[model samples]
Target chain A: MVESVEGHRLKLLEYEAKEYFRRHGIPTPQGRMVTTPREARDYTAELGKPVVIKVQLPVGGRGKAGGVRFADTPEEAAEAADALLGMRIKGLTVEKLYVEEKLSIVNEIYLGVTVDRRNKAYVVLASSEGGMDIEEVAAKTPERIVRHLVDPINGLRSYHANLVAKRLGYGGRKMLQFAAVIESLCELALEMDAELTEINPLAEVGDGFTAADARLNVDNNALFRHRELEERLLESYRGELTEREMEAKSQGLTYVELDGNIGIIGNGAGLTMATLDTVMLQGGRAANFLDLGGGATPERIGEAAKFVLGDERTRALFVNVLGGITRCDHAAEGIVAARRELGVEKPIVVRMMGTNEEEGRKILNEAGVETLGSMEEAAKLAVKLAEAS
Target chain B: MTRFIDKDTRVLVQGITGSQGAFHTRLMREYGTRVVAGTVPGRGGQTIEGLPVYDTVVEAKESHGVDASIIFVPAPYALDAALESVEEGIDPVVVITEGMPVRDSVELMARARLSGTTVVGPNTPGLIKAGECKMGIMPAQVFKKGEVGVISRSGTLFYEIAAHITRVGLGQSTCVGLGGDPVVGLDYVNVLRWFEEDPETEAVALIGEIGGDAEERAAAFIGDGGFTKPVAAYVAGRAAVPGKRMGHAGAIIQGSSGTAESKMNALRDAGVDVGELPGQVAESLKELL
Candidate 1:
């Protein structure tokens, strides 16, 4: 049931965003990601200055959640890295630490560029109040925030950047510099195909500015054009993937593991969610959520079935398909093939309708696979089978 | 007397040579929709299933005087196709392409608004005026001509509810999938407005899921006397865990805003009947009716 337009987006880590900033001549504190305490200590020693050790997680509110710490010495940096590496922030374990030279901030300014859904344009938001949650600022002090909508066709112009900068109370050289920064950030957002590119607390250090913290969310739909980013994402999440999930990803299937006994599979997202809801209503929990996507072939269905059946937690399998473009016969063939190839003994309940459903049901019935006419009946049977098992 | 489309509505199929375009065109034609012309860039003079194909929406409009366009263009070219229809002054353009880049959708929606054209679905099943006209990819057997108008963000969920409603002998005036994307051309408010103004539609069934403030916005609109029609609502993804996306790109609970419970509460507060299950939607609307 994956919305073809809304694919999974990947959030870049702080260090990754810093790399992009460095490439684009945007000022950012010198930083490198360290997976080990020794590496963190070495980087701190090389910098010869006080540094901030931040837990490298893709989630927000890191500072408020104790994911950010300061270290004045190499020993302290190592200790901080040790404390953060195994820490859990927002359900994700911090396996790496971004150790960067801490900068003296005279003022904190916020700069962000995101697509404004209502306006249907890219909006660049800037505020004098930074280094804090922008949402909180918007709620508490709405006057501090200034928003400028950039035309998608004309792109972000220098005048537009200056307008935003001026609104944020910048003037003269600082205004020009901030405008330049906003322009560069907009360029970076365009280059990276980002849904959001933000620099909270763009630190005003000495006579210039440096992005103290950076956040980037790359659009998943546009990821096909950016293979390197996809590779990096895969590499970063290499440790998080279960064997089945990894296999499914390789085979181009959307699979999410859940703690349940009934493995649920469907053709579309809406149908899959409804199937999950129905399973729960029938006193059953789904083991996983698997979508075969649109127009699944027999081979692809077989592969998906094999992956689900192979899960040790899965006690029964429920395949609910309301086929439109997806031919039901192909789905049936895949299920039958998986049953024979994997020799899965789990009770499989298949409910399919639309697009050659009769032929599909015939194939399933011929293979001795149970085919139900309704999703409700199929869910009840799957739950019954799971409970019996 | 459907809301947006009818048997007399002159239809143009965009990307007619494509597999989905050809398939649904035949289905729409079979269902009695006047599919006048088709647009397929290079297949201008070619005929597919006896429908004349044009190179552009302008060409199709100039020749056949098309009123509405059902787009079957791929995701990459969906914006251009929709814009083409909008530029040609088509009243409503139904885009069936999925996986369109959100940025492109934003641009297309903006242009559509400027041109005073209505666009539906960059990733949706489109719209069907039960028994009369079908512009989407939904199974035609499930819908029957009636007075209830249906709007949903999820395609399959809309079908499920439509099927249940039909099974319960509550046919629909029109059913629309707004496309389950973070950004879409039309929202619940737009559809609700149409249903409210639609003399044929007595009641409306809103199928929403966890994500975005569209449901809440719809509730607010209804509360502000925007929609006078009796509204029955069903929200999917009740079992969906937070942060984890359940199929629909826009069906994720971000913070506390887009939750099934929250949406239900909002709708209930707005004096709309809320169904606990898809099967219960018909019964819920019956209470209001």
Candidate 2:
């Protein structure tokens, strides 16, 4: 039940992932993004062939949700677009459709490069089995999947790529083509600082291969280095990141909106998440998850408080500060200040400890705000307050 | 008997002129850590808190014989700072900076592995030997000298649980934060092995959040008799939804992997006592001891 939804990475949608693929010399189906049925029909008519209309959402199971449809005629493409445009899948509205020229696929193969956290390296996974979940393939028939751990220093070398291609049962010129796609994917992953770069079902169409589906998850910390790509991919689509989430990002805070009434704020990521979990265990739901990071000053704490309190759904606020690098007094000041400034009679419960704990408690107590000693106790009281409110 | 850091460990601070670097350096020194030197790139030949600031880790190592280096450089420059220390053959290069690119962390870990240098974190509160030395940004007040070796993925949760342990008249021997990022230098297995070797550590308390298979791996290690010490654990993120990054880059339940339930079950199956809450962690460890 750990329900925080803080997406730090830039997860590019299907169309955007393919754009990177085309840029990296990997073959993909020619596609156009359309928001309306007219645009979909126009794009399909221009292609002069059957097209696949796929709704652009960050979530999976789009096919199961009927977000994917194939149309031979432009009229049918328009109808498919009309059905999908305003529909919701996995809580995300289908604002756009990706129409691609249907390709004659002979075979499907999986190729990807992702960060192996345990190994602390980029692992390239290739399999003859594709067009299905790779996890399923790995779990059910792992022997079919060939995994190669790329040396972080050496990167994905030519030998590594060739070895993976050979394992996937490709040889001669076909192996070379497969190897080339693997090289490009590795290159793209490195250049973008991507956590994951995947091509599912690398369709074999007569002469060569084409990426039928692609996913690129750029590292959040490397977003500064990829500002241009970030603006192009993230800012344009604004895929999973909401308005408040974006605003919180700008404020140097990690915030995720949940459907509960208690706004939860803590200094560190794990503690904040634990705060949310504790609230849940106490039979209360957290309205949001916010980590104030380390060494939060009074100003930053106030800013975070204001941001969390800005939500109309946040009926009560729970501030849990263990105060390692973060001073408990600063957190207390922020809570008192935000409550005073907001002037909304929302109940606030704080549990402050560690550095300057007594001072912090005094500040909150002087402000007539309730303060608890234990995180579980504070969470219980906050939940009780939220339910009462 | 102490692990990672002791009172005699010669420490150096990178990015010493920065606010966080300078602040933590003083605190580390105040807690009896021998913070010998600092590196501030262009701010070489300057002095911060009575310690000479060298332009490079090579110079600092030559001058101060620095054993460990704590990095406080910003995310963009963390890779360069960490590499400099690793190349200089500094053991246990502690990276306190958060949000370091996973690519950078991988490269750092790779280089560290080749050099036989132990890298603590790219996003961590660092490690401390209770009542002896402190190398991270954690407040020195919460910990006291005792026999429990504490390891955690989160900085504040480490403190919260450590304080609880201390409150119950138990203290930590060496508390190490494995960092809260997906790709980190040290994992639970590495720390568990070290704690197993530490003579003073009677029991272990592990604070794990939902992310990665680090805990599961630790459980496997303990189950395999790689570590025979009594262990108690508390895993957070019981309420985490799949596909959502829970604050920490590493603290996400991706698909069916990295779940709290899975981690807890693994530890419980390994004869380790698993606690439901953070407070229960110390209590469970107390019972195990």
Candidate 3:
């Protein structure tokens, strides 16, 4: 899950989205979340049939990562579960497994609803092709993808859904069923404030459609209106977040860990990113990205500084501040506080300007931290110092 | 000569009784904007900083001919504030509230489009015409009156670039922040169109970051000769790793799209000067002018 505009974006795992799908009257295969291999075997025996064990991680292309396995018996279910329980896919460990009864799928179709940022509207995308990455499909076979923009006020109407269904080659009773599913998914997306709700491979079982795979990305800013949903998914969302991410989330900071040696801290997302880019342009890699949002107090800055430096991979620290709402003197004081607190183990370079620049430079100059006026110059110095260290 | 706000433009402040609303309203007033009146839900007949406060946008609009509105209402109630202003035919509504649900923004944008009202941001620092009018939360000290028009996606970065431009003896005609959310009102295309029409704007400075194809679309617009002015652009996030969001909600690379290299190449292809750093944008613009 990524930090969104105002809060942390929560992407519900397949099992979690299926839980929501069942609650919203969308047909889905019966499934249970199991943590251990014994539980997976027990669930398979209870179902009295073949099952598919899927590792739960908030990432795409799980099947390509060998995270999905099929088992025909209870013993095979346990073996598959054992193989997947501790497996790591896309830097996230498989802490839990979802076991569901296998379906005899005759055909597959793709259906999804999401906000189209460019159009500034809600859009419904459907295709006859399924179980493939939608982006890949859109790029290779754009003609196969059918799009319908929903009216923001009136929402997804029956006629619109019917038109998309017809375009996807559905007709008669199956068309109606498919149209109803579209309407239901649209309603669900709207009600839940989902950024995206997708059902890839809406598997055809005889006459009806079952959601073979589910994806739901809820808007974190809208969580206030959804207390029940937040309560239900908060623990799982916490499990998905890394330790540093949880710390950043609690402290109202935006932090993303990366593989590098230099610790980077800056004000605003754009400046922080630009600082990271500048650092790289100077031949230095950043260990993490940290942004002190608007009105950042000195204490918050110090806390973020300490957190970034706490990483064992970070050999040097670079604090870049273009103070607008953020005060440069405050930023400088925070850097000083951090150095005093951390006992001066790492090389530090500071590029401070705007809003109390003179006072900020004075503070940093007195603290014996290397300070520079130009961002390029500071980045170069940071790269050299990090290399030397 | 400015495209959005000017000294004669009568502005209204929504959620004027709130702390952020009240504070920025004072700053706007001090910056010489004609902040005529304000609106608060139940603060009718009240006065903040000697400005009259109304109970609703309708009351404020009826009382004063509000040309534009700057909203400081919190996220949950910002949608209502914006809708009220749009329904009243406020030409440009600047939403400074962060944490707003994008769904609410989409709904508001639909109505604003029908009303022909230009909405600035749902999470924005706002816009300013140097030495003339100010809207939103950007620091007013760095801006100096000049002929260059600036459009940006980030706040502090805008200030950084603007300060650099000012230091280089080239000021600005107008500077607009298009907001930092995934969905925002008035992207590079809209502002570039306005800048092309504005007589005072001789050149343009565009500060963009990773995310969306807004920069690419702007490049296409310029490449197709939709905009004729010389544009200098600096796109952030060149070193951003794929799949990791770089602070902003929209500043992320999915698969191979929305990369800084892609945006820069597009701008360069359009015959625009694409800078390697923020300060280089000002240097390129100075040379172009």
Candidate 4:
């Protein structure tokens, strides 16, 4: 059975990251982190000429998102700052603005070290060509991207860094500088228990290296040994992240916010995922994917149901579980308890098979929650209910 | 007649002072496991639920001759405990802890292969030999001594198997959770091989979930060897297709290998009797018996 405990939050901000890279001798552009629009405008004016006023959101792609803008004139810079300071990038509202003198760069490169989702190993990627958008870089000039999969046991070696730099078509001194920065990046990644650290346009400026756009993600599970990372993740929750989400995360739950009418619940990861896909397949979007875990209590189930419905987007709920290590009877009782406590006016479609399923189904039917026999049927019912509601 | 565990299996609890370690250790001892010792640095020489504690696996091994270790340590420390157990030569290590970092699990699991040590779980529930011995987190009351052997990747689902087995008078030889992590020590093929060799394990109840190619591989092994003993398989997450990341760092299925469909198809191809109902395990056993 798939289980839910909360998963870790991805924590790292641009200002903190820039400061970190700067200290490590990786050149960052002349910039200021300002919370106030006045500070943002003033910094742009002081920087003079060509400047990039970017929203300091935790998520990626501020440039394409219009969260990032450039202005040649002072008034235009001020206007851009005002527009982006309050804007949202990928659902995260901008509370701070980073106004920086856009560096004069001859070359732009993408250097990143991220834990492979499959192997959980640190993988580094580098590519030459700065200033262009990363997506365009990925799509059109994909051959420019060079990759190195570092064995966690062996770690990132200097020779490996040199290979990536060389493959990016960088020659001699620039290649050496890039290799040196890669080593520094590796140190930062390993020391921080980082899941990812991407420096798009790690520029080869006049005699130095600077990361123009930085994206770093630290491994959440490894945060116990890293109290520093815990502080980094805490920034996103500065009243920005919802309490429900934070609670779900802290408890090791992998909660994704979706715009759907049905709240999907299941035990195993596969079933929970299927429920979401099936909801969409039947022309219904899912509000959330909540796995109450294999051993979730009736009380936990009720709380989860309440949490899912709390989004105000949910009109119906779907619970799919095939009990194995967890008894189906426990799941049934949990659903019953949830229904009684939450007074679920929302329609529920349950497909439970395995381990005391009959007893579990009996509890659900008696509780008046509609129970479906198949996952496909449950998804269809949930979609229909959501549409009707 | 459990294959992997019985009353004689000398058990050691890693992170014996933690909440889970404390909780399940008591239950395991109460269920009649020979929990000879525990490990929790400073908590050594102290007692929890009346079991002796040691500072390290070495101390536990020297003093108690702990052959198997039931890990209650947290995820970060799981690899350390697993490695230490192997270093101290603890056989059949049962790691009940979840959230193990994949890198460490890979190293430890790899080490397990090299050292000839058996590792049960990084996020598994553990193993139990019906009434004779309870090595994992399954409820004790559900078990009864008999021939059917239950094996799963999840701990909670196995409880359902146990209850059904209990109801049908076909007690479990032992239920093992290989854990749901992507890089685990044991897989379906490994466990099934053990079950095949065990005289006490007659009809086997193989419980699997929707990820990993462990089942496909297991089916191949079974097909090649032709396990004459009746094998009952129940693959959960029937409709599960979304990429569910591993909760247990060890549990992951890459490429096209470990999907639920592939595992199910593998079992079907192997000519193993698969059950749709939990109680159908008993029916399978009845036909074989």
Candidate 5:
């Protein structure tokens, strides 16, 4: 099982995220993202006093982490915007500030939609009281939070939506509107194909409706058909690239191009990562982590291995793989195929398992690729190879 | 005879103009997969590696009776390319394109539901019935026709399982790549079901990881007596750090319960002899049979 979530952290910009929520009919405070601090002053004035000034980063836990702040005055807002505008938090450069008009927020509550890991279904989480330090909210009043898992097929029914609102002490015809928003959010979460979405301080300002302080993380997996949503994700990348990394990226190869001797060829993003970790831990740094990816045939492996070996920093090569759907023997064949075509001038460490292990070993051994046992052993050998190089 | 795919299954290659598309399409032909047509819009009627190219999946399918397809389109074009195959009435689409955002996969998969078309992967290695048809980029030379059936989410783990099986003189009847995408069409349960009904397949080898209740659901199906066939499950990520997921979106196990340990426990509880080492799966299967 190759389990990985790549391209996380970089998220849709605030203007886009809010627009997405607003387009989905989910209530969010009216907001604008400004490029310059001058626009920040204008948006703050337009939003009036008591507005939230957030850095508009993609990562979660930002509010508690102080990536988000509220400004009581336009002057305070401009200063806040300046502080966050160019601030780099967790590799994401904060480029814009989301200055939104704050709502009355009588009863701040926490509501979220996430894929419940245990049940393998979409779940709806609601709390009567919202916001004030998420940690404190979860700790001080755990009982207020109501959770419901929705069957992806059946979806979140009206009663299920009402159940959350009723638990939150909402009722009457006004309760229906609350249900509508909750239902809308849940529907939108599923409709938009989100991984998780949180509306902390889903407020109860007026009797009938409330606004949502929306934080929606659409599942990147479902972005294909959602042209608008897909566009939002393009905004997620940092887009900052070093010259070499950009050159590698152009070829669709994720080449970190570290100052190391061993070039690792593997499949599965996680395995590739583990390979990197192993190599680093074993007193060796990797030139690059090349996941030929699953279904990497001998030819593709051959090509990837050649490319990895071609790097000037590469003095040795580490090929680690566990053939799940893609066979290791084929990868081994690719190694031999590539080496024969390109010639292996450097020592290669091979640790391969899964489908056709014997054949894989045989092919590599015949080609003179030294096969190791475990990933740790492979790393140790790689370290040894690097030192020798 | 194989159920889902066999030697005679007519095929089409999407993105046939690209190097990846052109190369893999040739391999499909060499492996005895009857690749009748290919698609690379504006490169219509041209031949790449000697296979006829078309403008779209619709035209290719209409002209060639293509039932199974292997797509080599880039990530950006992968969704529409896969969907075009689906729209053209193809079943069992094997999408080899990686980096397709998760959302595109979900949309394509949901659309597959509407048409009853099964998409193998947006990020996956396609399925193959050993000694017969090859769907994705499976290395045909390593595979041998035998009774042990295999299914996996990651293409590479299939190699380990096959290697172990081969060491014991066992070979695969059918190897299905259910794919790594979270929203892929076939899952553990689907392939397991096919293995259960396949006459030639004696024992089934399930290669799985954490995340997605695919493993647990397969366990439920097995526990409910849906699978009379013996199952041996080998799950990866034991060496993986607590929070670290492997590749493939569905492979991630968030929260406490989605760990590989939990998945292994669930499978064992359902009577699957889950293996820890790469070679142990074949050993467990030998005991069961």
Candidate 6:
């Protein structure tokens, strides 16, 4: 799994994640993200029962943070939405609320499927004790959790799902129903290219099961194959991007904003991270994390340089590149072009090596940009320059 | 003797017609790796850089006696390409493609495990046996032939440390890039074990980043005392923020689990000399040696 330019998984909202469950034939609480109190009231009135108003923020632990509330009446639902709409949880503002009919939960079970990297297989985790904290349950009552590794070639078979359900103390019709949920979850995970798909608290209501909450993280790398999913993700993330971030996204560059004086740019993620660490170690804080990626052209590098140095907070720039697939000359040319066009006054410390190093250094020298040979020296110079400015 | 690839390795380049594949194939060939053939479906009988091209791994193996396959397929097609090599019973398959889906990589790993085929990466620079043979995108100029074995999870960091080792007049037996992805083939433990068994490798330079417990597990394996080779490590991402992925899919601080501090402490506890910076690795290795 390679990180997208944005870094980390694109976490789907509760409503969004549940939609996958619903599409996969798993029973999920009927819900939709409502922006206003009127929409919440309208949805609650249609349900005609006690509903849950959950603040839709892309973070976990909303239940304990007062982001979730039960509304018995339409008016209560509207009030819950009003109270939650403008609230913030985990630094993310709650602009929407997922309104769903509340299920009378007799039992809560947890089921999750993810790649077991060390074991090199797909691990399906099931626990009878759920809804609260699965980690706590695994730690306190380890036997309550049943772990099974699915064979990659054969995938999660019906028998395997039945075994998981049987281990969780389900038998007869209930066992069959629970097994279906497991099978559906597996299918959803496989079809969606999901890195992690979890149904925490698969509530037992009367005779059937309802997915109370779900967490689905699709692989960003595979998003190219899922155009509809990508469009949906973009629709969900419409208002989340800053103006600069959106521009970087348009250019297909990974740029993460930070609060510092030095702008950091590198070719690879690992190298960029190491540059950040070196800058910090030398008493310089990084203003952003910008990766040019492999096989970046001179034009792309120049665009990245302009984008990063455009930030007003940046007093100095550190361009650390160890070119393998990416040629150092291309990166150098880009930096030179950015400096000329943007008329950047900040001190730009560049450290370049490997793959056309001599030509890259010559280009930088001709552009009046002194390049350093070592990462440590370059980082120190950048920090000193930032402090001087 | 190197554990994976050597001069005799008859390499097959998957996706040989692609830009990256064509470029690195020539570099590997120039570096003395026996790149016997290439595979590009529907392009069978075509030749790239004088190397014969086949439509499938089976066809390539039949005609050229392929021992290893370096896959340069795109992200979406990487799993299928790697699996094809595994099915063909390629001894060691190196995938240079990055950004493969984690689920797909997990499946590839599982299949490779069952077949006992050693897979290298879905997002890596591959590996090299110094001056003898190379199967990756690493700059050959930075590497020298000698006894120090190198294994890393980061691409650029690996090059940086290897350059330092070369500057200090040291060389490597086999330098393996375990990949920057969260799910990868040939992790730290796998390469470390091989380094321990290889008599030519007297010391090892283990480079890791924040995130994952591979380094911690490697430390545990070393702490068992069965590994006699002295190991020097450098864990990057010390300045990384919590929960932010520092480029690599696996390089992130997930709560307090995968921190640079924690990894360094673990390595230190296991009697591995840990460096604070990439350049300091040479000093640490000098002390260990």
lDDT of each: 0.84, 0.87, 0.87, 0.71, 0.72, 0.85
lDDT of 5 by residue, A1-389 (tens): 11223223224555665676787777777778776777878778876668877777666556766778778888888888888788877667777777888777567777777655334456777776676534355566767667787755567789988888887788887577778888888877767666766677677776645554666666654566466665555445444334555565456554445556788877776456557656776778777756666566777787788788777788889999776556778889888877788765788899976568888999888877899756678888988978897
Q: At residue B237, give the lDDT of candidate 2.
A: 89
What tens digits encode model 4's per-residue C-alpha lDDT throughout A48-70? 76788778876655677878788
In angstroms, give how far residue A171 of model 2 lies from its true place: 2.7
Per-candidate TM vs. native?
Answer: 0.89, 0.94, 0.95, 0.74, 0.73, 0.93
Identify the superior model by DockQ, candidate 2 or candidate 3.
Answer: 2
* DockQ pick, better of 2 and 4: 2
Worst 10 residues of 1 chain A by lDDT: A1-10
Candidates 5 and 6 compared by TM-score, better number: 6
Q: Please rank every candidate by DockQ, starting with the best.
A: 2, 3, 6, 1, 5, 4
In angstroms, give how far residue A203 of model 1 lies from its true place. Answer: 1.7
> iRMS for model 2?
3.1
Candidate 1: clashing pairs of residues: A1-A268, A1-A269, A4-B99, A5-B99
User: 1 or 2: which has the higher TM-score?
Assistant: 2
Candidate 4 chain B least-lDDT 10 residues: B246-255
For model 6, residues A126-197, the per-residue Cα lDDT tens digits are: 998778666576657878888888788888899999999999999999999999999999888888877778
For model 3, the superposed segments whose C-alpha errors exceed 4 Å read A1-8, A36-48, A71-95, A231-242, B1-3
Cα lDDT tens digits, model 3, A127-238, are 8888987778887888988999889877888999999999988899998988988999988988888888899989988979999999988888888888766764545455
TM-score of chain A of 6: 0.88
Q: If both were scored by TM-score, which would come out higher, candidate 1 or candidate 5?
A: 1
Better of 1 and 3 by TM-score: 3
User: Model 5 has how many clashing residue pairs?
Assistant: 44
TM-score, prediction 2: 0.94
User: What is the C-alpha lDDT profile of model 3 across B1-289, one tens digit per residue?
Assistant: 1348888989999988898888888889999999999998888999999999999888777878889999999999999999998888887899999988889989999898888889999788999999999997888888999989999999889888999999999999999999988888899999999998999899999999987789999999999999998999999999888767777777878777888999999999999999888889999989999
